[model samples]
Target chain A: MSVKLEFNDETLLCKLNGEIDHHTTLPIRLDIDERIESCRPQTVVLDFSNVTFMDSSGIGLVMGRYKVLNELGGTLEVTGLSDNSYKVMRLAGLDRIANIKKGGSKNGNQ
Target chain B: MVINEFKMTVDSRSVNESFTRATVSAFASQLDPTVEEINDIKTAVSEAVTNCIVHGYKNSVGRIYIGVKIHNDGMVIITIRDRGCGIADIKKAREPLFTTLGGDRAGLGFSVMESFMDKISVRSTINKGTTITLYKKISGRAK
Candidate 1:
């Protein structure tokens, strides 16, 4: 899996692609955690629209991100998750912690 | 006639190695498995080897014992064994999304194994080791 980072003054958007299995998680975790610390944006959003497949590893990644952002006093949001991704997220109870937006809205903030 | 069998050793770093797995899975594709079945087998194999590397040896240098046997009854059996930290609670570990190593694991390995294979069994102890056996029948399935 590959993760693309988009940074602005207010948000740090993470666009993840490919399968989120064990092989791809460690590097992604370290990289994103470092970015979050350095950038320290107001909000962190993960766009899963492009993700083709995901399993529990992906859920753990999202939970880890939420914990990190919450500690930083910044909120976390998820947008454009595929149906399968959404199912896994909900099953893992991530839909409660992270705001899972349905549409492809650029400004996820209400 | 004796059926074909294959064996390989996989390290944690090489657990993501898909080429060999793809080849093996392709050979077994003649069974005409459903899409979910194929994905489950692949995921289970990946998780088992990963567990050997991550949880079994705790990322230390170790080898995963893997054997693929085609039974005369037209059944495919894949076994992965690790001589590392054995599981304390196989039942708890098998629970979906229940990982002992925090983010170090996804806790879906056993679940995926059960989902993909026709039968899955695990035997382990505290320090001796752990063995995961997966079985799938190769008959009456469509490609």
Candidate 2:
């Protein structure tokens, strides 16, 4: 998986691509966490517009990140989830911890 | 009657998780499943295979067996077997967010499988192996 990171309006946005399963989550998590440590954005945003497939590992990724950001007093948000991804996210109870929105590449600006 | 079935074995490696999901989904395409149905099957398959690689094997390499049977009644039955360490407590393992694995594990594999598939059952013998079977019906065409 590939992650494109940017900082806009005090938010660190990560755009993820390709399938996300147990195998591909380590690197993505490490990269995002490292950035969260270095940049220390007020809110860490994950953009899933290009994520083709995801399993429970996606939930783990989000949940783990939520803990990391919360510990650092930062917030988390996710955007651009497809119908199925949103279901998985909600199933894992991520909706309660993170601000998740459904939209395309526009970055939740529908 | 079983219209068709497929089985394959792969190494208990993380890289094979995605491959297994795609292969199973491709074989499932014969049922003419919808995109949502395909995603559901793929997600369930991923969770099963991942359980084998991440938890069952536990840093060791082994063989993971997967079998799929497509019945004439539009039901797809998938069985994933792993010759790794079996689960000590099956009931606890099936609970949501009760994972023993660290480093980005939500302990929701079984929960995901249960939610995505119509039926799921698990059988395990400590130090022997574990097998999880999933059943789902394609609401599209049966034949």
Candidate 3:
């Protein structure tokens, strides 16, 4: 499983690990959406510190989640993004839709 | 000057996305690219491969062809080709946030590829297929 779910207060935290790609996103999307539907939290945070690599698929995952949370009147926060991931997010215009925070760790699990 | 190249064909399935990225990255290892440089190549290749799997062969299974070449001058060239439905409008498709796949897709695959790689070329025929070639230079190579 690439996603680990945790509920803190009214926020749903999804800690993502492994490499995120087109094939792996199906399960991850289902996992996160299931949690969002169950709790309907005020904010859903996608933590990517542990994610080793990401492509445009990661952008799609975040956009899809944002739509889900938006329907529930909840917001989305992206955190723990490595520099490489952070750059991709910015290019996808994610910074405008969600609060994005860079991860403290170096790239590739270092 | 050292030169290396490889070619591969894989099923246009989501499961092969990561594999394609890893394979291309490994071949690029011949240039001894830095972490950042390698990551750039991986991400760019992923976008192209994802396009083949998700967009090119959206409704059916097909074969995806990929070729990579590295020059001692620190340049890497990768070509991803798909024998599936071709894009009608290459310009619009390359636009960021433009996607026909809709749900769960940012339509930024081409943009991401263009961003990570120094240059990108796209060619397609209505019913033929789409072929994309990406170019990037790996800086910081030792003399």
Using DockQ, give the best candidate's number: 2
Error of 1 at B1 (Å): 12
Ten-residue stretch with the least lDDT total in model 2 chain B: B97-106
Displacement of the residue A105 alpha carbon in candidate 2, Å? 5.3
In candidate 1 the C-alpha lDDT for residue A104 amounts to 70
* DockQ: the better of candidates 1 and 3: 3
Residue-level lDDT tens digits of model 1 in B1-143: 22768787766565443543455566556566665556556656766777777788885767778888776666778888888999998889988877877654556667666765789999998877899998887664422
Q: After best superposition, candidate 1 residue B96: deviation in angstroms? A: 4.1
lDDT of 1 by residue, A4-105 (tens): 898997799888777777767789889889999999989998888777666567777888888898889999988887655665567667778889965474
DockQ for all models? 0.31, 0.92, 0.86
TM-score of 3: 0.94
lDDT of 3 by residue, A1-110 (tens): 38989898898988898998888898999988988999989988888988999988899999899888888999998888988999999998899989998965222333
lDDT: the better of candidates 2 and 3? 2
Better candidate number, 2 or 3, judged by TM-score: 2
Ranking by TM-score: 2, 3, 1
TM per candidate: 0.76, 0.97, 0.94
Model 1: residues with Cα > 4 Å off, grouped in runs: A49-53, A79-90, A100-110, B1-5, B14-24, B69-76, B103-106, B115-118, B136-143
lDDT of 2 by residue, A1-110 (tens): 98989988878999999999999998988899888989889998899988999898999899999999888998888989888899999998899998898776446443
i-RMS for every candidate (Å) is 3.0, 0.7, 0.8
Q: List the residue pairs that clash in candidate 1.
A: B32-B142, B32-B143
Query: Per-residue lDDT for B4 in model 3?
Result: 83
